[model samples]
Target: MFRLLVMRGFALLLLAAPAAGAVEEALPNESAAHLSTLGRKPDWSELDKYQATITHDEFVQLFRQIYATRGCNPDLIKVELDVARILTAAETQNYFVLHFAKGEADRRPVPRWWAVPGALPNEARTAGPLAGFHIALDPGHLGGTWAQMEERWFRIGDAPPVEEGNMTLQVARLLKPRLQSLGAKVSLVREKAEPVTPYRPSDFEEIARQLLLRTGVKDARENFDGPADPEKEQTIAWQRELLFYRNSEIRRRASVINHRLQPDLVLCLHFNAEPWGDPHHP
Candidate 1:
């Protein structure tokens, strides 16, 4: 569900108005003073001091308080229910988890009070403007064998074909160094044509079936009078692959971003296409 929300939120991010600028900038001395007052790190030990469990609503309230105190924008953050752990009857409770792109908002005009404690060694802090920032680049789509099926590949006449997945990857590769030169740490969600998630069609056959049914790619009552046609069979297979790529594959990428990389900011790169009235004109 968190994966679904993240995927859906990308559209909102693209459509949102440019963030309003910070009300005021913190001077270096003021930044240092703020850091001193806020302390050097969050107290994780406090977690052990709290009750073992809390209602989902309680967690949301707590998270809101924490976010407000830290001046985070609630509108930009997403909170979702996590129910992966429920081994016992008493443990069958749902909990809420917050997900957001750290440092991606102009709302945080003031610099963070303390640097991520272990993010940098003492010497590297002098690297450049983005010295301590971490950015994750997610070049969208599985381009290799799935480009055409994903509807991200197009060719008109003798001109070179356009592949959105491949293009985004190239962009990410090129942008990495430019950001790095400014001292930001960078990671790519996928460095190659393959998906980051290990899931395959066989692993979620039921999901594929449902997706095909919902999309009208397959029908319960429609059947050929004779034996199955090879071409139709092939089309069905491709449709399943499309469903897996769109749903499962993307969710896996979200998992990698939220759990494994956990970078301060995430960028999903892609290209848009429009109808070509004349193949050669544009």
Candidate 2:
């Protein structure tokens, strides 16, 4: 699933990053002061101290999601991407990378979009924004048999000692209980430990790239105008129909679940990564 092939040399570096997302709790002011004393440069010794955690792809996926909804400038988003890249890369060096740093938040890249004047996203700008909105909780995907989250520590650049499948179920155990306590209905995806399943895409990028390569459209990286004779509506019609069916499925699922459960909210939890983008620690 990853576009960039994995390398074996970076084991120590992966140590500094963690697998989980940032906590809901706020950081103390002094946390920022700690990272500064560490050199700002990215290297292997700077990375190995922490556990191997999030990947770049995970970070970028989220950035894209927020970008589409927030109308934030692309340039600003990229810096945070760079920061994650730098920090994680540094972890390949040493755990002291954590201690050497100071002025915590300052060490992190400042999001330019946050500074754009009077340009807050509608969600951010809203007061009591989600007061009446109900959400559904769906912990998506089945981990298939014995999703065991092993209790082990990972040094950077090393494979996870525990199985991810079990780890996910353990997480779901914690999550499902919490949401139900909050008066929210939870519809979790199957985590049964079985054979893996593949979801197909209707997007043209993969198909287009293959066709170009096969046809000797040498510069595969160059923007190849999509095939259109203004005559062939095949791809166009297929695109629209796929989109409609896909969107309808989403709504249909929501409606069916809500109708059955009379839910006030829908919450979908996704697990996994791709070659798409950088993973942010913050």
Candidate 3:
């Protein structure tokens, strides 16, 4: 069961979503190109480590089942007998080729920063069953004063509000020491009820306006300080806040886990909260 989790973690890292941020380096002559929402231009060199580590069939299965469920796009990606050609920059028509192994015998070991339990040295394993396992616990959202803004909170009549972020953090805190006792190194993406990103909603205002205008919103307002209006909810102000909390915060957390901590497994803890017809009764 533990080994399975580590493998799943490896797969998750491979299919990780495009992160939020400005492009680290601009493509020549296409510096002004519009990227995905808060998305950076991907570094194709990152795929180098995965070369020849996966079989052709395995690549197809992961792509069809996990990466792109709607089916492959020939324009964006093309699969051949032993290599997958992925378009890195559409404007430049640049492609990144990934070579696949012929079969299990032909496969190269996947190069990863983290080590599995069985791969660890004997001394490392002597600590405990979970020794050498690096686990990252990401308690979902930013709780506290920001919970209501992120919409992770709700209240019943006389009862205290149920905040999903706070609850997840509580669970992570309780689970941390228990996992440590098992000799696994545990790290928390969010150790408190605050945000992980240094950026705030105001910092995203310009980007939000640009997005709104590009999406054909004729009059994207400059600044917004009014009450929440359902009819006017798609304004720049609302969009900026959404980008800050959802995109920037998540990207920062991912950066910490991927680059700094390099955990073997990342457990994102969350709880579902469905609407109750009557808060008082439910």
Q: Write the per-residue lDDT of candidate 1 for residues 39-105, one digit (tens) a residue.
A: 1222222222222244446545654453243433333343445311211111344323322223233
- TM-scores of the models, in the given order? 0.51, 0.25, 0.82
Off by over 4 Å in 3: 1-34, 121-126, 221-228, 273-275, 280-282
- Maximum-TM-score candidate: 3
Considering summed lDDT, which 10 consecutive residues are worst modelled in model 1? Answer: 30-39
Off-target runs (Cα >4 Å) in candidate 2 are: 1-135, 141-170, 182-252, 276-282
lDDT of 3 by residue, 81-125 (tens): 989877666567787899999899989987667676668888876
lDDT of 3 at 24: 28
Q: How many steric overlaps does candidate 1 have?
A: 0
Instruction: State model 3's lDDT.
Output: 0.73
Global CA lDDT computed for model 2: 0.34
| Candidate 3 residue pairs in clash (backbone atoms < 3 Å) | none
Q: List the residue pairs that clash in candidate 1.
A: none
> What is the Cα root-mean-square deviation between model 2 and the actual structure?
20.9
- Cα displacement (Å) at residue 37, model 1: 46
lDDT leaderboard ranking = 3, 1, 2
In angstroms, what RMSD does candidate 1 have relative to the true structure?
15.6
